[model samples]
Target chain A: MSESETTTRAIQVPILTRVEGEGALHVRLRGNEIEQVQLKIYEPPRFFEALLRGKPMDDVADITSRICGICPIAYQMTSVQALESIQGIAIDPEVARLRRLMYCGEWIESHVLHIHLLHAPDFFDCDSAIELAKRFPNEVKRGLKLKQIGNRLLEILGGRAIHPVNLAIGGYYRLPRHEELAALVADFEWGLQNSVDAAKWLKGLTFPEFEAPYEFVALSCPDRYAIETGEIASSGHTSIAVEDYEKFFYEVHVPHSTALQARKKPHDSTYFVGPLARIQLNYHTLTPIAKQTAEAIGIAPPCRNPHKSILARAVETVFAFEEGLAILKSLTMPSRSRVPYEVRAGEGVSATEAPRGLIFHRYRVDGQGKVEFAKIVPPTSQNQAQIEADLRQLLPQLIACDDAKIALDCERLIRTYDPCISCSTHFLNLHIERV
Target chain B: MSRVIRRVVIGIGSAHGQDAIGWRIVECLGRLGIDDVACEFARTPLEILDRCEGIDSLHLVDACIGPESGRLHQLQWPDERIVALRWTSTHGIDVPGALQLATELGMLPTSVTIWVMECEGNLIEGAWSSAWTQRIETAANRIARTKARAVRGEIFYRCDRTSGL
Candidate 1:
């Protein structure tokens, strides 16, 4: 291929690396005027919802936890909440506190993993975290240490870090000992300070100037920053009941991708979820330290720039650590390990703010307490259409740049959302065709 | 001064089809009740770094898509002619890449050995193939015996070489 021939034609990245799962990106151009941008996800659907049919209500949490390795607690929490809601089981306040702590562990592990290992490298123009570590050893080490602490917290409360076996339909199989919870206090104190420092450190990184008008969606709680559970809240002040998710947001099948794209109805437009959405909508409810960190970093709400999501995630990590420490300090043994309940036929729906965004789980149980139908809406699928929309808005400005540069910029934009394609249906091949 | 070797056996695989061999082997080792060696299950290769930290020796077992079915291939780290092994998950980091990163980050174990069983038949979420059941059992017993020997101060290096079944 001659130099001019290469310069005039397309750019193709057969596979997208670093991001979780399989996907491809295709960009079609008509002499510098971009024709189309497609973020194609080709990972075969695992049929998780279909497979849940006939499974007992007791098995829902464990089964759904297999959806993603990174955020199993989110799956377990959502499924457990749905199952409990179906039976009209209101958990003990102590049990609720423990669940929130466990969820914080997940948020810490997942956010640290993405910020330091997965997404941070993109900012420094490195291939992987290993390469980034070579130059910034101290920062990488701090991140890994924070991650280890998160894993340890999970191990203590949930029995295992990957897929916790201790969670049950109503609550945990057994309540942890006071000593067990107290042992983590010292480490969590360090972790809280470390997270604050990490956020400040990430605030100093260079971010590309780009922002899209996004309809942010997340769970909003009246009391605290929502993580474990809340109603589906949108930036437009639309508060939809968890059971009413289908009425507000709908998933549509696109021919180019196996994962379904979700859009808010009535307007029928794409919306954003995940860190940026959560922080913007619930910044007031964040812990005092978290709010201070956000302010110190100049990350006040209404954050439109996707790249600043790294900062948002770090801020949330601080909140997780602070909340975890508070929960540990106020720990009390529950009167009962779990609320005893008889399972009856009913339908239940729940939505929790996962590390990425809002994860909704709806299940219809038969009279025999077996799952009749299951529907799960992960964050990545909800962000797919918005990702494409962002690319559409950003690509025209970069029309004169080389194809490779445009492709990398596109990848950086997608990673800003920390899209877990594994949880959704998974990328990404990049093809930029010029006609 | 003689250094004490802390050994860990990690079985890496999913419940998908023939891939369950790793979990099966780890279960078999657990049945042996070995007090000196630790046995763990890893859902993905990227978890290997966490499982291997501070360990003196490591043994990993997994099924692989290779030339021959129901056959075992043994590989040791630091070998110049190590065959490139690719993990099946596109979502998680591959084993070799993760190990390389671990080494760079000073997290890799002192010694590493991997046992890969060639997979056959459907690679779906189901039962293990009957053809490899006996092979898995034999490999598990061998690994157990190796752990017993190592506990007895037997320092064996490059003991099992790859051979066709």
Candidate 2:
């Protein structure tokens, strides 16, 4: 269209094989020149904010959780934290412990879901886990059984496996009794072993050599890689409280897509965050079993390549199970199932490390306790730019490969972030023009 | 007279809705304490697809949508068998689209049998419909009987136990 526009950006994903939300990558190239690489998120936006405006704070958890059927716990946990921060009420220790355990279940569920069902098949060049099931029945079933264990924890503790209902501001409506939770342990322990096997199994797959410099960020606690809650930090040494995210980070809407894009202040360049970042930054905090497995995989302290992310997720699943079992062992029924609260008005930010990465919720409440304003940042939105960066790096290598192989390779790279564009869609129809 | 299935079965659509209850009817058979029946909520039709990886027989359950108001009808695919129509369901694409896609993708389970729920009479909206609600009762009963046989492995043309021939 323009004299200087020698290159065209083209990206197209027919079925977008591995990721949960359907989408495509569009990149433009000129003769020997790279033009544009856009990580187009095409999933339809469900308008969760408009849906949340009229509801009371108590309903925020359930309403927002429904936004993504795959990662509801992230929504529920973040909403609860924000609402509780607004009320300035602290939950009981038993309730806190129960919440952490549930968070662990979510981590296991989300990570395992991404690893086994969505991402792993890329290694074997398969379409879906079911297809993989036909080839490697034992491995696929092991992963599913392990994931089922995590889902069972969510079902029993959070009230339903998919979109749990019991968790609330002060605490869960009913803490799962030890006996109820104990039944899960046997399966969970079995799951942990299978998790080890699963991780080892994934390690045997072929890996790519493409690596890009990324702004790795997550909630890195002093004691653990924060999956539920912690301070926000990037490898760039920029660390801030959850409340300060707006000051250093910002969201902008791209004309090509509906999902708002996130960028660090000043530059619109992309940064990476999620399992790779979380694992790389907090390798020391991993549970003993997880650490050992990581070592066995030669992942060292931190894993940087996006291709090895399935391993990071697998290791995190092991930690989540360990953490959940410990928490479940000590949880008791609260004296009162829920703490009574009167909605007092204020603005607060609730942040948690979702399975993929940092998830934050900011709420402004009225004196009567209805939400006046709300904003949420999912991990996928934050990792959009970095996903494109990886694509840019991988595209040239994809040359000479078959269209199907290229598609599979690209999808695997995207799933490495476990992107959940379920709430937003910002994508352009990719045009792969040969200059 | 030679026996032919005169039973009108109604299938309810659930893929678009949460719980995918239409398909769950097929899924619930094993737990409901029943035996010797066929049911399925197929995304596609393929012969020998339902044959178990190890076992020798299969039953299928799938969602259905059609003209019968709270009624059931029979149809077959790949391996032809009567599909009992039971109820109508909420689905984006029609039953034909789902089956065709599954067949193309090789996703359809083998040895398929299904019942369609004709739902023009009563559609369960919001919370589940009452079991006593008359329009839905017949369909539910059809599903129950359909599922009963699946639990007995009579309709499950094959079960997965051993890998590869």
Candidate 3:
């Protein structure tokens, strides 16, 4: 071997910017060959699952909601559905519609926040949202306004915007008054138009040209785009009930991450989730305008480019706004907020589409309505392995650049996933070592 | 009618440990029932933008990690150091970034002041001690009585040396 080829080098990014939670990235290179790529999640493990044991099943929704500030509704919704299943409780159709509306609020706020503040900056080559705001003040303001409307919906329906207290096992604790819902109609209409414009604007941004043959995974619903609940579907031609989530997908501990990485069972292959995956798998179920927007932007299903996930997120934002407005216009205060049920011992599992991706929750309850076992697989953990795999595929293109350039490129690609490292036991400061 | 200055006091923090100082101050302001001043609580710095509309004057209180546990620091609007100091956040933008975004969106009030209480060590999940409570009360009282002083663009520290609960 030549002396240059025998040398070792490292590239490290000590802090990753523009994504959620705490995490760092490390890459090792031997000559021109990539040795390893690790998406390190060093945040101390939060024992939420362990804490749920022995708690009342009724309290599970509120407790699990504490897991992610951005998508508390996702956690709350999945947890309640799981518990409700255990009790053999079927919600009133009106109650279910309102629940879907509330989830739309979460998707709108979470997706808009990510599209504008978190991911857009990378495309613009800006260091932070502040920089992006200076360059595109109008766009940023519109995004913020849309996010605020979503938060208002949550405040009205779920209680406060963060860790909303209104959710219960069977249904909501209190129904929103018609007047309160009526007041938001004007803003929702404006948001629906604005999101379409935002998606068009996002389509103009220059995204990196990289596509992977990823196995896209998301929830598929027969009646509509899956947000609140559905069967698990993947691009690899696999469909399974939510109860069979464990049989299809499994988590394994990796040394570099505090969060367990998820992989497809049997083959142990990495699969993608979140906006890109959802959009590809559920395109037919998207709202009319959302479909129109996606088509207008020149992106369709089978878009494997991770960088264009921003476009997918923008399209979803449009769908969320339209869906929310329809529900708001027709929803009335239900006679009873929740259906009553008797507690009995049983086990149940549920999957729902969070803004980021599909989140899974399962619980085993005793006859006393106490939790016997609890499991939560957040979207970020499910995407961690896929993220690392993307990085590995991306490194060859970046290897020719300097260490700093390579680090920046890697960070940009990882941000495409919009991984809530905090939700995943998250991180990224990048270091590339060459030997 | 004379111009009615719409003044608002915003406390930014979570529910855990000394971090709750911001929330505590707002609670104290509410309990004191200071007239003509509105009090608000912000879980994160970004939420500050949501409460800034149509207000003429804004006062923001938050906790910071500095040299001392109970020392109080104050800075006025346009103070450049406010952005340089430890005021950013990992969740998104920092307090200063939100302030800037608010300014850009034309939502910032004409007069602004920021008060940061410095605490040392890891901020655990609980309430503060009696001495800290007394300090928070004193801060609340001071904010109620005084408007933004002429100390514009200055950082002043009110480090209390006396130690008793």
Residue B45 displacement in candidate 2 (angstroms):
17
Can you give the TM-score per candidate against the true fold?
0.91, 0.80, 0.94
Off-target runs (Cα >4 Å) in candidate 2 are: A1-13, A399-405, A423-431, B1-112, B116-135, B145-165
How would the docking of model 3 be graded? acceptable
Candidate 1 lDDT score at position A98: 92
**Local distance difference test scores for all models:** 0.83, 0.66, 0.85
* Runs in model 3 lying further than 4 Å from the true structure: A423-427, B66-69, B87-90, B120-130, B148-165
Ranking by DockQ: 3, 1, 2
lDDT of 2 by residue, A1-435 (tens): 754355333445544544555456665666545566677665566677777886788899888877765578888989988989899878887777777788888888778767766777777877665566667766655665676677778878888766678988887877777788878777877877888888888777778876777778888789766876778888876678888888878888876556777888767667787777887888888888988988887676555688888888888888888777666665575676667788799999978888878888999889988888889888888887677778888888875565556666676777777777662222223345444
Rank candidates, lDDT, best first.
Answer: 3, 1, 2
Instruction: Encode model 1's per-residue lDDT on B1-165: one tens digit a residue.
Output: 956667888888766577687887888777878765789888767678677778878888887775566666667775544434334653445667566667777777767877777766566654555756677777788887776776676845553344431
What residue runs in model 1 are displaced by over 4 Å at the alpha carbon? A1-8, A423-427, B14-16, B27-36, B67-70, B79-83, B122-134, B144-165
lDDT of 3 by residue, B26-133 (tens): 788889886567899887677888889898778899988766776666777767777777554646667887898888777898778887777887767554678888
The true-versus-predicted C-alpha distance at residue A241 of model 3, in Å, is 0.8
List all candidate RMSDs to the true structure: 3.4, 7.5, 3.0
Best by lDDT: 3
